[model samples]
Target chain A: MKYISEYRDRQVIDRLAGQIASFRDTKAVFMEVCGTHTMSIHRFDIPSLLPAGLRLLSGPGCPVCVTPVGYMDHAIALARQGKHIIATFGDLVRVPGSTSTLEKARAEGADVRTVYSITEALELARTHPGRKVIFLAIGFETTAPATAAGVLQAQKEQLRNFCILSAHKVMPPALEMLASEGVKIDGYLCPGHVSVITGEEIYRFIPRKYGVGCVIAGFEPADILLAILLLLKQVTDGKPRVENAYKRAVRKEGNPKAREMMESVFRPVDTEWRGLGMVKKSGLVLREEFASMDAAGQIRVMVEPPVEPQGCICGQILKGIAAPSDCPLFGKMCHPGNPVGACMVSSEGTCQNAFKFQSDG
Target chain B: MDELIMMAHGSGGKKMHELIRNLFVKYFRNPFLESGGDAAVVPPEPGHIAFTTDSYVVDPLFFPGGDIGKLAVSGTINDLAVSGAAPRYISAGFIIEEGFPVKDLESVVRSMAGTAKQAGVQIVAGDTKVVNKGKCDRLFVNTSGVGIISEKHTHIATADHVKAGDQVIISGYVGDHGMAVLSQREGFPVKTGLKSDCTPLNDLIGKVLERFDHVHFMRDPTRGGVATALCELAEGRQFGVLIKEPAIPVREEVMGLSEMFGFDPLYVPCEGRVLIVADQSVSQGILHTLHGHPDGENAAVIGEITTGNWGKVVLETIAGGRRIIHMLTGEQLPRIC
Candidate 1:
């Protein structure tokens, strides 16, 4: 807890909050594009510390929140086929599909298991050779390299029963799409863990092209307050640049080995996002050489066309255009226990975070 | 006797009688159990009686600090202790899997006897049975406890008695039992040097009930940790609870593992911790008293009840932020997504 506990020092956080409070002059909207950042911001109640003019928006950062309904439907369909053992991260198990969730599928006797990492899924395949182990690979750059490594490890060990259903996404393309769509933004708080893998250089485009300040931030109260101060200073000075506020962990060049492994195993492909619909080259797919390890290509299962739940504005919520309370079904027909949208399902979802922390007016 | 438990041991024949007399009675020797009757007959106390039962089916029958036997005994005792009752007697039932090593059974029975003695309670009555190998885990224990609650303490420590301005005091650290079990079961690579906090709290609670007149609510943060206990105390109530994140004590090792696993320590389980709500006037006195005991050395006043955010639990974070702490819905599984 050395590095973690120090960043949570109350004295440092108060000083940084004061700095941020002093610099506020005009209405500015900043977005944090990582699920962990969004969760940490809400977990620490950072909004209450900010001045009145600055507004922080949660962007399409949660991989589970942004994953389209069809992909989950397909995964659920494969799980229901009774031939595959579906291994997935815990958050995805609760995310609702068009008709069913992985939790419901599991309760209905599907062979679904939750694993902490993709390597555990590969290990499951090694032990349970009689059944096919299909890993529901999902996340942004922070987790993609691990999945890629899992695939390479599986191939090296020649594990025939191991495969992955890739729903991996990249952050830069989604940010570009957010900027191109004229979403109001003055700066960006880039994801710390993702930047650690892809390097801070990947986020320089936002500062250069859109003239928006981008600060890669760590997931601590002081770290976030410092990042906000940096962004506000850039706005006040009429200058925009890529700044690193999480220098303790993230590096300028990122982890070269992880990037190399990710690039070697997967390729960028145009994929659909839940709210931002069909962002070009925003997702990663398994390479053709590793096609046999792709669960989508290896399994032949028919799934119905994905259908959105009626009156669920998760799309708008993920895009940061709508608040969770703005939805008609929020806290009425939809809740964490019986969620109708992805935003109400995962713990990192904006709606879930808002519902848990925000006061009801 | 066979080296391991067999089907004949459950047949209520000569083998069953000898096993009971040799193993059960040998360790759990007491005047009440010596009667060798189907029921324990004791004089009624001059107060209300508290009765509770629990079953333990924990995997890896043995854990870092305690096993299923100790867990079953301490768990039942803690339930009664937190209710402002002094536990007196307990009945144990054991279901042994066939082919289980007799040595392990003896060890479990010894652990149960040791825990019950430490709690100042007697295993007055008992039953034993054997099942097929796969029908049950290696061993399972079911315990029912009986305690005596005085007239004054009968209704003083219920959640309904809680009101605004009451202070919430948590005894010791949280998440030790949960992380210990998870690490042992999953073989986590992280070396946490952590052990389960699974001791009986009857003595600790007894000292407080004897000296305190302002106790409002008392609960052990067992399965869902402090967060769930606070939520239960606030649910459908007229008051809300606000806690300080920095005020809650969590071991550095547990904190490190929680961070690595994407888990919140508040939602993890703790077997030997209690959350006590008392009047704010005596909160400091209660903290001082709790800190004097070994089990409550790390105790602190974590939060207070308020009229705002009724029926909810909010945490004032270390950095001057606030968020609602909800009851855990499902398992606190790791998040890689």
Candidate 2:
């Protein structure tokens, strides 16, 4: 609370709001890459405090929202097999994969489980020596290290039953994908949790290569407001710099040990994103040295890269070009209770975020 | 051994003491447990004390907004705080499964320490019991609290004091704590990056209690969210309550998560936040004070207690349509605190 509470002061917000008001040139779009920032801005009515010219958009920082249809199809394949338990992070449990969710699979009597960490799945393999335990390793860099660590542990333990659905994604490639797609992102509010692991330098590539001003921001209202102010100044000055606005938690290089653990066990590969097509070096896979931990690659499961659902605009929503309301079935046809798209299934999904908060614009 | 919780662990046998010493007494060892008693006796406290006891067995011991430990402490303290009491003391009881991981138990206990430390309450007493894994879902924590109600403050517990013109103000966002717990517990991918807003609301209450004379009623919206809390205040009386959906501070994450899981935040649980119905004159003063506090930073004016559907909660939407804010039929996500 000490580190977090002081940063959310109201007096500072008042000062920052005035600063934001004075800085507006034209109605500009500032895209926050983290789902937390998106919610924080909406939670405290931070947008109302800002000048009407400052338009904030949510980008694809949500891992669950970006996970391709193919990955969910793969999970569905394993779940339908009923031979192994498909263990995954709690966040991935409700995401509507190509045909069904892990929860639906479980309801249909598939051996699906929700785990807090990859290690919980690893322990399951240890406990149930006979049954195959395939951990669904889906996340960005912040969570990839934990899955990689779990893989390393599995190989060391010689757990034959333990394997991983390696769908871990990286940030930079996706940012490149977003920028080159021409989404009109004036600036970026980078992810706090991922920056803690990848450091501030990972984002430097974005501004240097694509010319988008980026700010590594915290999740509080003040933090986001400060990041927006910094971005506005950068945009106004025609500067493209990756600034570390979350210095309290993030460092220049990030967590070295976490990087090393991921590097040692996993290698970057081309992986498909939900909205964006496959990008090279965007996903982490268990190295050849740790092939035994690779379930899909090892078992040689030919899971065709599944197609995105017919009407789901999750891809467009993820690109910040479209809101959840853009879809014909925002609340009418695709409510959270009965999701129609991947974006509608996850809380971090832009559509769901918009739907829940009712921010139609 | 894993099927049923055998009585040997609770029979005061070697296994019983081992279960106590190794597990229960291990995480919860305090002056009370160290005192060795059937029920620990209270020492002493200041004048006109307020004590409230609550047993939380909400399934999914861990939820999006909080776990049983956070709920246990916050729930107990909120009960006292709404009754015009300043929380000072607390006691906890954990009903754990036999094979419940010691580490998980420790994490919940550590969370309790965090909540207690923030609330300025001491864990004066506690007890632990281990049922079989099949008998219980990991853990369930029951907590009781004690607080000192200042003599100068009028009791704001009952709704009979709430007038037709009283203004209803809410601290922070609605359905945040509930959506967080539901999304996390159900593992819905709408990862809102929103953690449970579980904290002590005593600070906000202190600010309001210290200010004006017209502070009428207060309650922490927990299970069934603001709708149920409002309905409780509306029972028997014929006061109409109209709230604007746009006016309420609902986080996009809660909405997103609720949309993803088909949950209604109006029926979701809130932990660190509170709902206050006060005189129109004092509403601004209370909001200002709450905004100053860490826990109540997101406070907003949601609606008011008016005089038509006295028992029902009505929500006015952005489109000028009205919908009844009703009590929860079923938990959007079970086992969430």
Candidate 3:
């Protein structure tokens, strides 16, 4: 609690809040592009601290929320085959596919395991050599390096039974698409963990081409407040530029070794997002050298046609054009227990966070 | 003698008799159990009584601070304690998988007897069943307890007397038992030296009830934790509960591990702690009594019942912000990041 509690100091947060509240009035709408940021914002009840003119919107940052239903069907297809073990992040197991979820499949006797890291998935393969183990690799750049490292470890060990179903995505392409699609936004609060790997420099293009302010932020209350204050200052001064508010973790150049490792194992390709359809060079797949370790190339299964849930406006919510409350099925038919969309499944999802932490007061 | 539990052990044959005499009786010897009857015939008590039962199926039967046996006994006793009763007798049942180590079974039974004796409760009756391999986990335990409560303390059990301005007091820290079990299961190899707070709270609760006259309600924050318990207390009620975030006590290790796993300590479980709601005037006296007990040394006033925000539990965050704490919907999953 040393580093964490210090950042949550009441006096420091109050002083920063007072500064933001007293700053010159500017009508600005900033979007935070990370699921953790969305959770932190609500957990701290940050909306009450901001000025009436300033608004913050959630972006397509949750990897679980962005993963397409087709990918889920493909994974379920593999699980139903009874020849492979599906290892995935815990939240993905509850995501509803075209027909069923991985959780339901598991309840009916499929070998689906939730792991904290890819290393545990590889370990399963090492122990259960007779069965194929597929790691459902899904995340932004913050998690890609670990998946890349896992693939390399598998190759070095010549793990014939281990492979990965890569749904990994990069942040820049999604941001580029959001900006080019003409979504209204005055600034962006970049993800802290992703920025730690991709560095603050990757966001330079946003301010250069679109003239939007970008600030890399940590997930603490003080860190988020400071980022918002900086963005307000940028909007008031009419100087749109990239800034690093989370100096403790993020660097300008980022971690070179992790980026190199990811590049060596994966190559960029256009992929489908649940809400935002195919963006150019947004997805990562295993390179030709590691093709044997790719589950998509190693296994084939029959998948039904993907179908979207009826009256679910998750697509509009992800594009930041609609609030979760704007959807017809917001709380009536889309509660967390019986989630109709991916956004209601993951804890970091905008709707789920709002449902769990938001108050009428 | 066979070094493992075989199918014949559950067949009620000579092996079963030998097991009863060699393990269960050796550890759980009492006048009622020595009769070898089908049920425990307890002496009649002359007051209102509390009866409760609980089942334990925790993975890795043996954890940092306690094992399945200790947990089974402590859980049942705590249930009766929170009802403002003095636990007097308990019954244990075991469903074990075939081929389990005889030494492990012996140790589990021994632990149960040890915990029962320490709490001054007699293990009056018991049953054991063995299933085939893979039919069950290594072991499972169920315990039922009975206790007596005086007429003066009976009002504390129904919780209808709770009113506005009643203070909420919690015993010690939260999330210790939950974090301990999770870390052991994940094999995180974290050197936090974390351990479960799995112990009986009957003595602590009994002392406070004896000293305080305005005690209105009591509950052990078990599976769903303090947050869920508070939510349940506020649901369908005429008033609400407002808790201060910083007032909730949490250990550094629990906080750190929860942060690493993307879990909130508020939603995690606590096995050995109690949450008491009482009148505002006697709150200082109750806190003084709780702090004098070993299990309640870190007691603090966390919140109070309120009139506004009916049927909702709101938290005043570390910063000057507030949010509602809802009942936990499902198992909290580890985050992708």
Q: Which candidate is the best by DockQ?
A: 3
Q: How much of the true contact map at the interface does candidate 3 reproduce, as a fraction?
A: 0.62
**Candidate 2 TM-score, true structure as reference:** 0.64
**Sliding window of 10 residues with minimal summed lDDT for model 2 chain B:** B1-10
Q: Across residues B1-337, which tens digit of lDDT does each residue of candidate 2 receive?
A: 2233454555557866665566545555567666768766766765578889988776556765567777788889888998889887787877777767666666677777777777777776766677766787767888888888766554576555777888999988887776666555443434557778877778778878887677888888888788788877777777867677667787866765564443567778787778888898889988898888877788899898877777766766433334555444333455556
Could you give the interface RMSD of each candidate, to one decimal?
Answer: 2.8, 9.9, 1.6
Q: Sorted by lDDT, highest first, which candidate order results?
A: 3, 1, 2
lDDT of 2 by residue, A29-130 (tens): 888877666655654456666677888888887888888877887888787788788888666777776667788888888988877677779878988899
**Candidate 1 docking category?**
medium
What does the lDDT read for residue A333 in candidate 3?
Answer: 93
Tens digits of per-residue lDDT, candidate 3, A221-287, equal 9999999999999999999999999999998999999999999999999999878999999999999
Proportion of native contacts kept per candidate: 0.67, 0.00, 0.62
| Candidate 2 C-alpha error for residue A324, in Å | 1.7
List pairs with backbone clashes in candidate 3: none
Per-prediction DockQ scores? 0.55, 0.05, 0.65
Task: Rank the candidate models, highest DockQ first.
Answer: 3, 1, 2
lDDT for position A185 in model 3:
96
lDDT of each: 0.89, 0.76, 0.91
B45-75, model 3: which lDDT tens digit per residue? 8889899998889877888888888889999
